[model samples]
Target: MAAAQDPSLFLGFDFSTQQLKVVAMDESLSVVHQSNVHFDSDLPEFRTRGGVHVHADRLTVTSPVLMWVKALDMLLDKMKEAGFDFSRVKALSGSGQQHGSVFWTRGASETLKNLQPDQSLETLLQDSFSVPASPVWMDSSSRKQCDALQEAAGGALRLAHITGSTAYERFTGNQIAKVRATRPEEFQKTERISLVSSFAASLFLGGYAAIDYSDGSGMNLLDIRSRSWSQICLEAVSPQLDLLLGDPKPSSSILGPVSSYFVQRYGFSESCRVVAFTGDNPASLAGMRLQQGDIAVSSYCLPPNSREVKAVESDTVFLWIADPRPALQGHVFCNPVSEQAFMALLCFKNGSLTRERVRDQCAGASWEPFSAALRDTPLGNGGNIGFYFDSQEITPPAVGVHLFDPQDVQVCSFSPQVEVRSLVEGQFLSRRLHAERLGYSIIPGTRVLATGGASSNNEILQVLSDVFNAPVFTLDVSNSACLGSAYRALHGLSAESGASFFDVVKNAPEPQLVAAPHPEAKEVYDQMLQRYARLEERVLQKSRP
Candidate 1:
């Protein structure tokens, strides 16, 4: 598609774990302006490590709501300082870090609507939240609630069948349940609850933004089949959640126009639409221009235009992942493209940071040496596998570093080069293993799309290709969530007109195939996966309290 008829701009924002990022694209789907706000370094007063406060319990992690608010304040000001024309932005959409919850104080909606153009968001809305710090996706302290939900729903598989996922501690429903149980006072004061995505949208919309179905599915509250809240699950957590959560909109629905605060304060056009924001994972799926079966207009799903084909093959293009443990679309999450097909997702806790730790120790904290080490080290590290996690891992719920030799005998460690290779291989191995368990596999033409800090490393991605035994592709940018949000912004305009998402984004640049699996990759990884699984099982057994 050529730049839209009017040559207007679509703005996409990503309220992520550590920062707030924005990308502006013209109708040509070309990025025209981009910027970001780093939480810890830029907003130092938050005093957050990696933008989160890890409670003494370690498993309970939260981020300051005011910090996120302030970051946005700074981000837009930076954009305005650069003389970007906000008035030309016809529509805007965004993706947020998945599952983080923001609590709105009673009457916050009215406070949002009547905001003063002169005041900063952080200043006027300082007391808008019931909880100053919101529970983030990193939290695992909601196990009690998870168990209760699963038991109440009958079992893990049943819950998974209903909600597209088993009860996960980081899920919003469990987090809300935890708050309701332990902090009844806070729960009582909360009038509206928003996921990080919708909350960010609420800031722009000047009212509560309805949670979109794509992100809503991650909460363990929305029914994957009906695309609405499960009454049983909601009642399990708290009473009358519908009033608090509002009705979730489609990922492509235009929520409303940007708030008066922006129009008067920062020169936004009154007519600029704010499309429904969604989870980062689904946004990335859209950004990657994924089609169904192979790729999807939404996460793991095909758009209505392409659904009849049953299976599709993509160009095997690339995207990036910046987070250490990115929540990737895989394994039957709700696909925003069509209700008939579900999206797939996989998340890992100890990704980039864990590898960076090993890189620091072995390769002088430099990627050049790190890449050389991976290249120099023999494949499979000579049958030496290592599991290195700085903190608790979500996948198998394991912690600490465990090393093993070819004989399955536990080892203390490896040389620097071997250690680097082990860490990279282990991460990708786990991704493939978990993906297969979800009934997805590496077909002949499987192509992985990702963008992130770690995705920049060709050596790391080579292992990803080898382990998955498929080719890996790459995009120019490192943040797929941001690009995907930008893509969704454009798609939302045609949504009411009934255009499939693929039609809107298909003309965007294609992914570059950075690496293909070596001839022996499939055979090598096949045997290695079983051993890694067994070792992981051993670690999980030991991790049990």
Candidate 2:
């Protein structure tokens, strides 16, 4: 007798800044297979350090767009090698690094729709991008564009109230303005401008994909209140902006069937559907199965929006829009799974990379040394608080490293072990400070869902737990963004049936509690956090030009 048909699978792709990761899941939401392509290590020919090319100003950062295209080709090959049955993947979605813009050349749509199965995607679409390099979220060289847009839109607060954020340099609106100002001819040749998330979806959908509402929130061009493009903000950024941005849709909307390119190259079924992709942070929120009252802190990833569609006792749907001030400090975007809900998001530029820097300096670039240092140092590092920012930070917006004594006196000296402990404490402390500003409180019953490269470190979680004074939990699966996208695919496909995303994944694995706040350390960190506030204000003033 013929073997029973294999369980249908869903695929999720996270096109992050430094890597491209894919996770496959069966109908039960259990991970079946996973793989990733590290830009620096896997595609060395791109000559990217941490997936970006940093220019002389130390502020201009861009990545080769073709690098992503080629990485996609290689990643699928890896998945095929791992015996992942592409034909079994019924639907797929993805998560991408927010605010990174991708420009398509004239006739790029024709190139995508007519891709040859016999040839590699990288080879077929080598000239598909009008702009060879894409300005990623790390670049902060758009001060001029930011100023002009803010001035045009009235001011920073006005823009923030409209777009859920001020005119951030790394945001797509400023990046687009800079391109129009600097390369007007190239802008004329550009057919479409897509965020990395939709750009990835386009690869599968066989044409340009519409931006999703949640990821669109990061563009500084979308009117968050109306969930549409702000014409004034668009005109402020560039001419004919609406033509360049085709449309924006909800994250759970199904785009179309997978492209023939996949069917020909990797044995994918033409029936495999492509769902809308969104920003990484939103994906994580969905992947973690976050309910109301839960907060997710991520490394190098942003936070969520603050709206929720509550089903009350009377069975009425309550559509709540949070006050936007908290978004000034971080970000708020629509929920990926449920169109009616939103979540709060906060990301640190000095996340894993900064810790890696400290680890290299003190512990020879190994976790063992890093863990030992945290273990040996006293709780709260004897009240020695440190703020480490290897790069410009997003929340509270400051740069530079500073150490303070228990009395809050600035100091430049500390033991390596003490330095190690200080860095870990500083990272989480800053998160707690900004999260509060965004109206997220750490109550006694609150749980911190920690995910990312650094979340596996027990010592780091200990500090995270102590600083937030909340229980820190890690998931059975680490790549929440990928899994979230996979879950989105399922949710999107079933959305018309009135099935809830939470109900769909309710039976999935539970998070394992890894760290709890030390009873004595909580009081110490509480005091240090107050001192951290004062010190950060001083640093911000010092950072001002």
- Candidate 2 on 1-545: residue-level lDDT in tens? 99899999999999998899999999998898989999999999999877888777777789899899999999999888888789998999999998899999999999999999998889998999889999998788999999998899888878877887778899999999999888889888999999999999999999999999989988889887688899999998877799999879988898999998899889999989999999987787788887655666655333211112221110001111234353566666666666665666665667776788899999999999999999898878888988887667666577888888888899987889999999988877887777666556555467877766767799988888888787888775478889999999988888878888887888888888999988887789888888888899999898888
Off by over 4 Å in 1: 1-6, 40-49, 54-60, 116-119, 293-332, 336-340, 349-392, 398-427, 450-460, 519-545
Assess candidate 1 and give its lDDT.
0.81
The C-alpha lDDT values of all candidates are 0.81, 0.82
What's every prediction's RMSD, in angstroms?
Answer: 8.4, 7.8
lDDT of 2 at 152: 90
The TM-score measured for candidate 2 stands at 0.81
For 98-190, candidate 1 gives per-residue lDDT tens digits of 999999999999999999998999999998999999999878899999999999888877777777788889899999999999899999999
